[model samples]
Target chain A: MPTVRINDENVTFNEGATVVDAVAQTTGRELTAEGKPADGGRLGVAVALAEEVVPRSRWAGVELSEGDQLEIVTAVQGG
Target chain B: MADMSLPPLQIGGYSLESRLIMGTGGITDLAALEAALVQSGTTLTTVAMRRYSPETKTSVFSMLERLGIDVLPNTAGCYTVRDTLLTAELAREALETDLIKVEVIADEHTLLPDVIETLEATEQLAERGFTPLVYTTDDPAAARRLESAGAAAVMPLGSPIGTGLGILNPHNIELICSRASVPVVLDAGIGTASEAAAAIELGCDAVLVASAVTRAQDPTAMAEGMRLAVEAGFHSARAGRIPKRQHALASSPMEGRIDLT
Candidate 1:
């Protein structure tokens, strides 16, 4: 099991789990719609892996590794 | 004079006809927000970036897109340069726009922009090809620093965020506007239509308001007021206001006095 950090929370994933899986395990939220994985974060969510921002299109291609840091961001209300 | 066109408010590469920019925070009602956004005629509005929450049903971005208004993501709650930069990067990626409002706040109570962190974040964001609209104090020197660091615009606070104090330091805001080569948007602390108008009359390129309309009893009416005030302010700035005088000068000519005749 490879240990990874999603936005600073340490978690272990099965071998070869991608970035989207790590996000779901850590945040208990999906980047995609419940039934729709094709449309990822149409609601303006962003992710950065190890401090380097990765767009939604590349989420599935980027696999998680040991000690990988993932930062998740979404749009919320503010002044 | 009535039909005179107001000068466009230009920031970065985008030129907006409306001198009013809105913030989406503090407005809980989506329908009301839609009405306010429409009535305000704001081309660029602010949205804050946070972690995705499945519980939250309303999406401000969807509303913005439906209305055809441009979204300007903000680093509103960030306190450190690193956090601000990260949030800004995420915002740029999420929004798919280079435009960002850099707000490195001091504390929870005041919510004022931290000068050092703001400048640092602005520089890093600018280097990354982002157009940062920096929020800073009314200090003219601070505004100059951000502009020198490649900020698209210098947004000086009229007072604290959401305080509605309305231009606490007119001279300071004026000084900032005078020295600023980029657009000087009077951000935050606007109480009503007059404050928005007054900010523009003080030479601000535009005025950013959120609570004044969002929290108002009738948000729709307040939004309309802000829109009209912005237009009025633009025209008043161009119409050439009379110089201030210690004593009142009679509108009627002295020669028109019947006793003198």
Candidate 2:
């Protein structure tokens, strides 16, 4: 089992799981059983793992490794 | 009723009721973007196209259409004339609009527009019957050249994109606004409502901003602030400012009637 850190929270995952799956599991998001975020998850926010922006759809293909930093940035509208 | 006598801003014969322009890149979600757009009271919205994805179909475009916003597709990542032209053509076909936000960057690090390439692409796009809104630097000479080349509007970056440093050079922006015949929009590098207001106060025709509102702690509130800032800036500009003098004013009655002395 390989472990990854998301926003400083450590979570262990199966070897081949993508970063998205890891987040879905850790955050108890609906990606595991239910396909989507119920109403098209938060916008303007992106998940950056290893300094590269990972599209929402590509979360499945992105494999995780030990000590990878996953950052989730959500949009907050202000002037 | 509040004074509603503000004249509509004309760009290529299109009268935009609102002076604020929103960028589609930084919204938390399409839904949020929609909410902010409504709150901002802006009719024009900008979207960028580079690496086309089939999956993006029906979601992004459809949502924008549902909001009834006029889309201004941009050549955000193009660095050359060929790519810019192709992207503009594709955007026209896909977005069904002849309006293009032309941004030709020479360096990815700073995201500064390549002046020569930008002019070349602008000339071509204008000749092709597309309304070109060129994003450029705050050089008066460059802005004048773009105007002569027939740019519909000239957008000068307040600073680098997404840094939110606000207006770095107010004098240069003022220079551009004063010299250009076309609409002058202060684009990029705006971090807050104050920055937007400052640009408008400097007599810019409009302000195009994204990350400031979309990346804020509360996007909807920030959008409203931006709206107010533009209005305030416009009003301030119209009201005219008093001249600043280096010497102190003689208000203390040096020789005048001072009964309490």
Candidate 3:
């Protein structure tokens, strides 16, 4: 098992895990290949890997690496 | 009487009927924020992007969605152009809107916008097809440059962020508004409803208030007051104020005082 940092938390996952798998494991919501929620609800989330934002369309192809720093952000109350 | 004299504040493809843009920063309770937001009569509101937490229960995005208010996501805490662009991209992805409030702060103490980086970010964001509403200082020249950089709107700060010191330089604000081709929105340092009105009276198309209403003792009351004040200011500006005179000019006719003579 390899560990990756997501939202400052270390998560262990098997090798060959895609970004979508990482997101699904962390958020508990499955995403379609198009990066939408499997249930057709609004996902309302975005992911940045190693300081570079990964587009939703590429989430399925981008595989996670060991010690990769991931940032998953959403809208919050602020100006 | 409600004043419906001015046209809607148009930016990019969006037309906002209300000129008051409420900010959600510093709000303690979501229910309270919703009440104030409804009372404010604002068609647009601001939200910021942060790391997602599963344990967090309150969803401000869902609340704004239910209230039918358009969310204007901001790059609030970004200090560099890179950070600003990244935050803005995230905002657009998560929120699914191209409207981004481009705020490139200088430092922590003052939290003033870094105009140099801000200008660069605005140009880049605009090039990326995002409607960048840039937040800059109350500098007329800077405002002009931002508008030239393809900003959808230029938000000039009244003083500093969350200081509540009110507009420190009305002359600069008026200058920015006078020459701006795009919409001019007074962004920060508003303490009360009067300041919100003052922004409009100074020729701003709209005003963005956060700490004033969200941190007030009674947020709902202040929100209502802000709504009324903005309306009053719009009408007063259009009504044409009388010129200032050095000497007293009595409204009563002097011809009626024959007995004193």
Interface RMSD of each: 2.5, 11.4, 1.7
Deviation (Å) of A66 in candidate 3: 2.2
TM-score attained by model 3: 0.94
Write model 2 residue lDDT over B1-261, tens digit each, in one string: 777555778888567778899887766476787888889988888877533222342355556667777777888878999878877775665455788889999988998999899999999999999999999998889999998887999999999899999989999999999988999999999999999999999979999988988888888899999999999999989999989999988767567565775
DockQ, model 2, C-alpha based: 0.03
Candidate 2, residue A74: CA error in Å?
24
Top-lDDT structure, candidate number: 3
Q: What are the per-residue Cα lDDT tens digits for candidate 1 across B1-28?
A: 3557667778898787778899887877
- Model 2 TM: 0.72
The per-model DockQ list reads 0.49, 0.03, 0.68
lDDT of 2: 0.78
Q: In order, what is each prediction's RMSD in angstroms?
A: 3.5, 10.9, 2.1
lDDT of 1 at B98: 91
Q: Pick the candidate with the highest TM-score.
A: 3
Error of 2 at B257 (Å): 11
- Indicate whether candidate 1 or candidate 3 has the larger TM-score: 3
Rank list by DockQ: 3, 1, 2
Q: Worst lDDT window (10 residues) for model 2 chain B?
A: B49-58
List, residue by residue over B1-261, the lDDT tens digit for candidate 3: 764765898898778788999999898798999999999999899999998888642288878888989999999999999999999998888888999999999999999999999999999999999999999999999999999999999999998999999999999999999999999999999999999899999999999999999999999999999999898888888889999999999999878576854
